[model samples]
Target: MKFVCYTDWNQLPESANALFLQAEKDSLFFSRPWFENVATALNDDETMALACVVAGSKVMAILPLMKSAGNIGYALKHRYTPLYSLLLAKDDQQQVLACLVEGLHQLPLEALLLEPVADKDGHLEGLQGSMQAAGFGCDRLFRFYNWFLRVQGQSYAEYMAARPAKLRNTISRKKRKLEREHGYDIHLFSGDDVPHKMPDYYAVYSASWKANEQYAGFVDTMVARFSKAGWSRLAILYIKEQPVAAQLWFVGHGKASIFRLAYDKAWKPYSPGSILTSFLMEYVIDTDKVEEIDFLTGNDAYKQDWMSDRRERFALSCVKSVKPAGWYERFVASLKRILKKQ
Candidate 1:
């Protein structure tokens, strides 16, 4: 297999081909644009992308990683984390993962650290072995759920009926109340509309994150990067003259990725967040563009009602070069082991 390291998505091919063909059907998160757009957004940071191709022709495996200084770099004195690096490929996940691990060792690096992997139910088997075979071990660093709302192949009525009776009642009541008490209107920012209106969306994102004592987690940069790469779009929920909540999602990758969320505190009781999500779900079903949506890697009550299926993700970290010398590194490994207990 020919290993190709690309600077950006433009260099990647259009078809799933040999390596990515399975990924095209199995995973929305592994799509080429998802990696390219996010990597480009984090361009200011130290990140590298490598694609594995078989015999210099077809794409076989894809890996995306960012240099978080907290991880152990080429030298052991400093620590860094390569955030959200993942393997994207199809068929025989075990073999695909094994190949990725072997390829990683060949690259120049100290260690690899991935966080916020989704805790899906079932299907997380043998991933540790793949990483170990590649020179890394498994660890549970952090937990999150990628929420999704099932779309495509279902009518709006059929979709709404699938929810629990209480959920349906609540949603209907809330939608009505929202219309009665406040003239709330929902707006969608398709990938095409993102560039022209993102600045305004960014403002709401910044304010919402700041109020929550956080930033939008690199969202503004990520959106600009994805939108420019022609991978995704921004959806904003506007109330009168102001923006209440905004979501950035992917359209190119078959699994629409829920990348960002920013909301106004004033509309908390009105549940603008859920309302905006419902709007997008409808849009997806109506457009029939994709079969599923990945709220990627997080489990929150607000985001769960719409999810049709659950997936468990495993994080494996290993280094063949040196056993970590520091107590903290050992402590992290210990913590990883401890997570299974919880």
Candidate 2:
């Protein structure tokens, strides 16, 4: 295998095509167009992309990367995309992963920080071995707990029964409230139906944030990229003609991701977010379209209520330079060693 690193995307243009195609054919996480679309949204400094391929062949796996000054390795994205991103590829995941580590070693940077890695095995194990053999037992962070509902093998009712207790009760009661208290219509954006509803979607998302004093332009960014890449959809629940709850979902391959959501402030008492999540799961399970539904972040109470499974996603930190932060990092290491001796 050869690791081909390029400073520019156009430098080895065919490489991306071959690698992306291979990812589409094999790997679920790598198949989504919006993965790259979202990664491109995070390019604050120099963006570096790498592809690992058989020496004389097309491509095997690719690594999309971005370089910042110190203590940060980006998933190579533009400012508009999500913070957690890496390249999307299918075959030879470990090869692509090792290539990224090796390629980072080539640069004269301080440290390598890959935040929000999606597939834990594809990189974590192989990269950990490589880093340790080189005399570095780098830090791994369990920053966020990922939530996912397994909708592939069971019916909605069956899936509900498998859950603990309170969740099943909530789903049953919420569905009843949605049907009885007021007539609720659930609308989802699909295919060409997206454009007409984009503005309304943005209003609900932004307003939801404004009420809490936290703002995320990520909603608008997600809409445009998902639409451009043709890899996303939105589901909204309306009560009496006003949009009360909205769930924004993007599908890439057999895995569908529910990343962001919003709801009217007036209906917080009704638990709009929870209801929307439950309904979305029902929709996916009923259609049998996606095998896994990823909440993608947060160890919050809501995730436990919605998802049947949990996977902790970790960030890999490999220290490179002996500069300023490196000094503090060394001090931290010394502290750890002293603590161990005690």
Candidate 3:
């Protein structure tokens, strides 16, 4: 395997993108455009690099890393981005992962901080084993659940009937109330409609309780990119042709992610946000034929009601270079030994 480290995103060849597209699974975060957008948002505060493994003309794997003090952080850092992984071809996952770890071992860094890695169907097992074998220390920082809904071959009514009666009742009542009192309508803005409808989308967002935040700039910058790439989903709930709530999603690889959402606090009583979400869920499953819907990152109380199945996400710290164990590391290791003795 040939390992190449790239300090410039623009230097990556077009062929590299084609290789990623052909991978068994695509990680939205690991995509070249996503990395570029993130790097653009970060400015020069942090450095970025792409470490890729290639065999002759084919690229097998790639890791987009950000440089911080002495550690290499994941390319994107945000709450909405809960899951991350190396982009590796399906057939060469093991070899590519192991090779990537070996390359990391040669880098001069304190540790590689990878977070919110999916616990199921992830490379944690191979990653941890390779890091340990390379004389590195590996530890799981924490774990959290990411809720998702699988779109089985069932209609929206069939799926809705399976939900709890109380949830079903609440959704139906709120939906009807909004329609009856306010004449609400849901509009989907994707493809060409994204850029045109963004002003309306932002208007509702500005009226939301989460308005005027620092992340707005980043969202604005990235939304255009996502939209142009054909993955943006902006669904707005309108009352009298004015926006009240919006659900921002990113669709790719047959999966749709619930990226951001908000509603006008004035509509709080109407529960327009919840109504919009429910409507979009049906639209994606019954209309767009998406295979899955990911309620990314958070395990809010309401998410549990919406999604019965979940996948765990984990944070991992792998020390690439073996130094004398720090006091904290040694203490934690010893405590584990003592606890096991019990």
Candidate 4:
């Protein structure tokens, strides 16, 4: 087995592309297009690199890495990224992970930071173990909470019926009130119409309570690319032709991820966000028939009302103690831990 790092996406071998295709079957976040968008939109001072573990002509694993501050590395991720991890081929996953861990040591990195990794999969756990076995000091830090719903073969009506009575009533009452007061319309755009409807989405988001997007054009470009791939589920709620709420969702591999959601503060009293969510939920459950719905990040109380289960996301910080820089990082980490304990 050999370890190879490619700085340019175009320089990646065909074998690597095949591995990415296999990974995409698991989550849209692992798809090449998603990674490309992240690279192009999120990159600032960091230099992106694709680290791979190859056995002959076959690629075993691919780690999306960003080199920053000369010797420190991080996952190629941004605030918009809900989950991040190394993409590995199916067969011999343990072996491939070990090889990948070994390959990571070949880089000039003293410390590597991987964040917002889902805890459901054993991949990150295996990676932690492998890094420890490779003589690296690893720390697992809590990042955020992820709420998700498992459809479990239930119809949309059945699913709604099981939700909390208060939630059901609120959605029903608010939706009715909003429609009666302003004649609201909810539109789900997935394909050719997504690009054209982006202006409405931007308008609603800008008027919402959330802060402006740190990376300009990131969400727009992502929605456009995912729309072209037939993975977008952009929903907009309009009251008399003015957008009041907008949500960007992606449906792929039997799962729907709620990527971005915002509602005009002016319409918050009418609960346009919740109403739009309810509409999107019904569509995904009854029409798209997705097996799972993920509320990707955050522990907001409202998420629990819609989601059935909660999972934790964590950051894996690894330090190569043999290097002086790594030793300094370890000292700082140890000091922080001690202070927290106190």
What residue runs in model 3 are displaced by over 4 Å at the alpha carbon?
23-26, 71-76, 91-95, 122-124, 325-342
lDDT for predicted candidate 4 compared with the true structure: 0.84
Tens digits of per-residue lDDT, candidate 4, 1-342, equal: 777888898888788888777777778888898898988864467788898888888888888987766676778886688888788777787788788888888777777878768766576788888898998888777778899999999999999999999999999899888878778888889886888888888788889998875555887788778888899988999888899899989998889999888999988889999899999999999999999999998899999999999999877788886756556565547534633452
* Whole-model lDDT values for every prediction: 0.57, 0.61, 0.73, 0.84
Candidate 1 residue-wise lDDT, 243-298, digit = tens: 88777776654557666677877677877777777777677666746667776655
Candidate 3 positional error at 140, Å: 1.6
Point out the higher-scoring one by lDDT: 2 or 4. 4
Residue-wise lDDT of candidate 3 within 76-132, one digit each (tens)? 455456567776666677777778877877777656766667665455677678778
- Over 1-342, each residue of candidate 2 has an lDDT whose tens digit, in order, gives 666766565565565675565554333345345454454455365556543434455555455667655544545443322224344355666666566566556656555555555545544456656655554446766555777777757877787777768767776677787678777888888655665676666667666744541334444554665566665678888888888777777775666777668887777766677777777777777763777777766778867766778877655566653445457478446434433442
**Candidate 1 runs further than 4 Å off:** 1-28, 40-60, 66-111, 114-142, 149-152, 206-218, 228-233, 321-342
| Per-model TM-score versus the true fold | 0.67, 0.76, 0.88, 0.92
How big is the RMSD of model 3?
A: 4.5
Pitting candidate 3 against candidate 4, the one with the higher lDDT is: 4
| TM-score between model 2 and native | 0.76
Taking every candidate in turn, the Cα RMSD to the unseen true structure, in Å, is: 6.1, 5.4, 4.5, 3.1
* Clashes, model 3: 0
Candidate 1 vs candidate 2: which has greater lDDT?
2
Best by lDDT: 4
